[model samples]
Target: MRAVSLVPSLSEAVARTAPGVLVGVTDWCTHPAALDAVRVGGTKNPRVELIASLAPDLVIANEEENRAPDLQALRAAGAEVLVTEVRDVPQAFRELARVLDACGVRARPRWLDEAEETWAALPVPDDRLRAVVPIWRRPWMVLGRDTFAGDVLARLGVTPVHADHPDRYPRVPLEELRECGAELVVLPDEPYRFTADDGPEAFPGLPCALVSGRHLTWYGPSLGEAPRVLGRALRAARR
Candidate 1:
C-alpha cells in the first residue's frame, strides 16, 4: 500500500489505519494532518492526474465526496479503490473495518464502543423527540428524510422533521414546520453558521441551539468520540 486519498469524513481513520503509507488528501482533509498535501484537490473535483501519478495501492472514496464521473475515471485508470458509505453508527463501524483492513492497520478506536453505550444510556427527553436542522438559511433548506443528518436524529431517539417540498435540498418554508411541533430546532455552524441573534425567534415557538454540523452528522473516525460529546448535549437539551 503506497498511498491513500480521502474526501469523506476525515483522514484520521485512514492515517491511523495505515500509519506508514503515504496519503494523498484534500486541502479540506483534516483528519490526517500529517498526510501529503501535494496531491491535494477539492472535495469533488480531485486532481486526477496527481492521483494517477501517485500510483497508490488503494484510493478510498465515498458517495458524499467524489462525483460519479471522478470515481469512474479512477476506476478506469486501473486504480484499486475502496468506497466507504457509513450513514449511521453501525454502518460507520463496518466502513472503518474495511478501511482498516485495506490500510493493514489494527487497534480499534476506544471511542467506537463508548459512543454507542453512552447513547443507549442517555435519558430520554420529555420534550418532543423532533428536530429541524437547517442546512441553509437564505433560501432556507433543511435535512430531509434518508440523509445522514436525519438518520443521526433517529439514532438519538429524535425525529427529523422536514417540510414536504420538491427539491432534495428544497427551499423549505417555515410555515410547513408549524405542525411538526418540534421542541428543539438545531442550526448547523457551517455553510451558513447561524446564531441565536440570527433569528431563533423566527421559530419562536421552539427551543433552538447552534450545533456543530460535523458531530451531529459527520460519521467517521471522529464519530468514535464525537457521539459521546453529542450525547451530553442531548442530555443537557433534555434537561
Candidate 2:
C-alpha cells in the first residue's frame, strides 16, 4: 500500500522496514537519506491538497505532531489516516507494530527486536539524579508529565523536576528552571538545538548533559542505539 508519513520517526521506521511503499512524506521526514517521496510539507502545517493529490492508501500521523483539522480533512477526502499516540517506549513499539502491520510488512524488523533487547538489557540506575530537561529556549518549554523523553531518562535513572506538572510540555522561565534544585540539566540538540557551549551556562553550577534529541525523543531505528548513546552522554555530563 502507498503511505504518506507526517511523523519523522514513523517515516524512518516505515522506510527502514519496507522501502518504496511511501509515496509522500513531510519535509522533516529526513531518514534513510535517499528517500524518494513527494514532500508534503512540515509536520504541523502539512499541505493537505498536495497530499490528497498523491492518492496514498494510508496517511500516518501522530496526535502531537499533526493538527486535527488536517487529519479531518484527509479523512473527508476519502483517505485512510492512522493517528498514533505514543507517550512512552512500549506505546511506541505497539504503534510501530500497528503501522507496519497496516503497511503489509509480514515480519517484524530486526531493528525493532534489537531496540527492545537494548532497553531490556539496560540496568536501572541506582543513583538517580533530578534533572530539568528543556526542549525550547525562547519560551523555555520543558519536558513535563508523562513524556516519552522523560520516560527514557527515568529508565536511565534521571527524574524530571516537573514530572508532576499538569502540562506534558510546560513553559517555565530560565531562572525558575535553574532554581528548581535539579542536580543536572539535560539538554537536547533538537527543538532548541542546545549545545555544550550554549545550554550549560544557563544553569551556572549544575552539570549539563548534552544529548541527541533523536535518541531521547524519536521512537524508531534509533531506539536500538539510544540506550548506549544516551547513557554515555548522561555519564559524561559535567559542570
Candidate 3:
C-alpha cells in the first residue's frame, strides 16, 4: 500500500512500522532522518497538487496539525485522506493503531506495545506543579485546553496554567503569563525552539523546564521515553 503522511509523528510511525509504505511525507517529518520519501511541503501548507500526483492509496493527517481545506482538496482530487484527532495519551495509542491498520498492518507494531507499557509503568509523581507551557513566543501562545502536550505533562505531574481556557492554544500577552501565579514555566524546543538562553529569562523567579517538543508533543514512538525524559528535565529545573 502506498501512503503519504502530512503529520510528522504519523509519518515516523508509518515509516518505522511499515518501512516501504510511505511514498511521500511533509518536509517536517524529520524522524528516521534518512527517510526517503517525496517531500510534500509543510504540514499547515502542504503542496496538495504534488501530493495528489504521487497517487498514494492513502494520505495521513491530524486535525490540529493539518488544515481542513487541504484535506478537502486532496479528497476532491480523488485521494483518500485519513484524519486523526489525538488529545491525550490513550487517544494517541488508539489512533496510532488505527492508522497502522489502515496502512494494511493488521498485527500491532512492537514499538506501539512497548510505548504503552512504558507509559503504564511510570510511578505516580509525589508532587504536582502548575506550569505555564509556551509553544510559541513572539505573540506568546500557550497550551490551553485539551492539548496532547498538556496531557503528556499532566501524566508527569506538570499541569498547564491555562488548561481551562476556552481556546486550545491561547495567545496571551507575555505580561499576563508572567503574573499567572504558575509554579513553573515549561518551554519546548519546537514550534518555537525555546532554549536556555531564550525562554527561561521571561519568567524571572519561576523554575523553567526546557523539554523536547517531539517527546512532549508528538504521539508516536517517542512516547516510550517521554515520561523519563520530561520528568528528568522538570526535576532538574525544580532543583
Candidate rank order under TM-score: 3, 2, 1
Provide the clash count, candidate 2. Answer: 0
For 122-238, candidate 3 gives per-residue lDDT tens digits of 778788999999999888999999999999999899889999999999999999999998999999999999999999998999999999999999999999988989889999999
Report the C-alpha displacement of residue 120, candidate 2, in angstroms.
1.4
Overall lDDT per candidate, in order of appearance: 0.68, 0.92, 0.94
Question: In model 3, what are the clashing residue pairs, if there are any?
Answer: none
Report the Cα lDDT for residue 196, model 1: 68
lDDT of 3: 0.94
- The list of candidate 3 runs beyond 4 A from truth reads none
lDDT of 1: 0.68
How do the residues 1-239 of candidate 1 rate in per-residue lDDT, one tens digit apiece? 76556654646666655566755886666655556545558768888778888888888888776687888888888888787786656676677677766777666666556655665665665544777777877677887755666666666666776633344455667777555667777776754777768747678767776666667766665665555666566667656
lDDT of 2 by residue, 74-106 (tens): 999889999999898888889999999999999
Error of 3 at 149 (Å): 0.5
Q: Give the TM-score of candidate 3.
A: 0.98
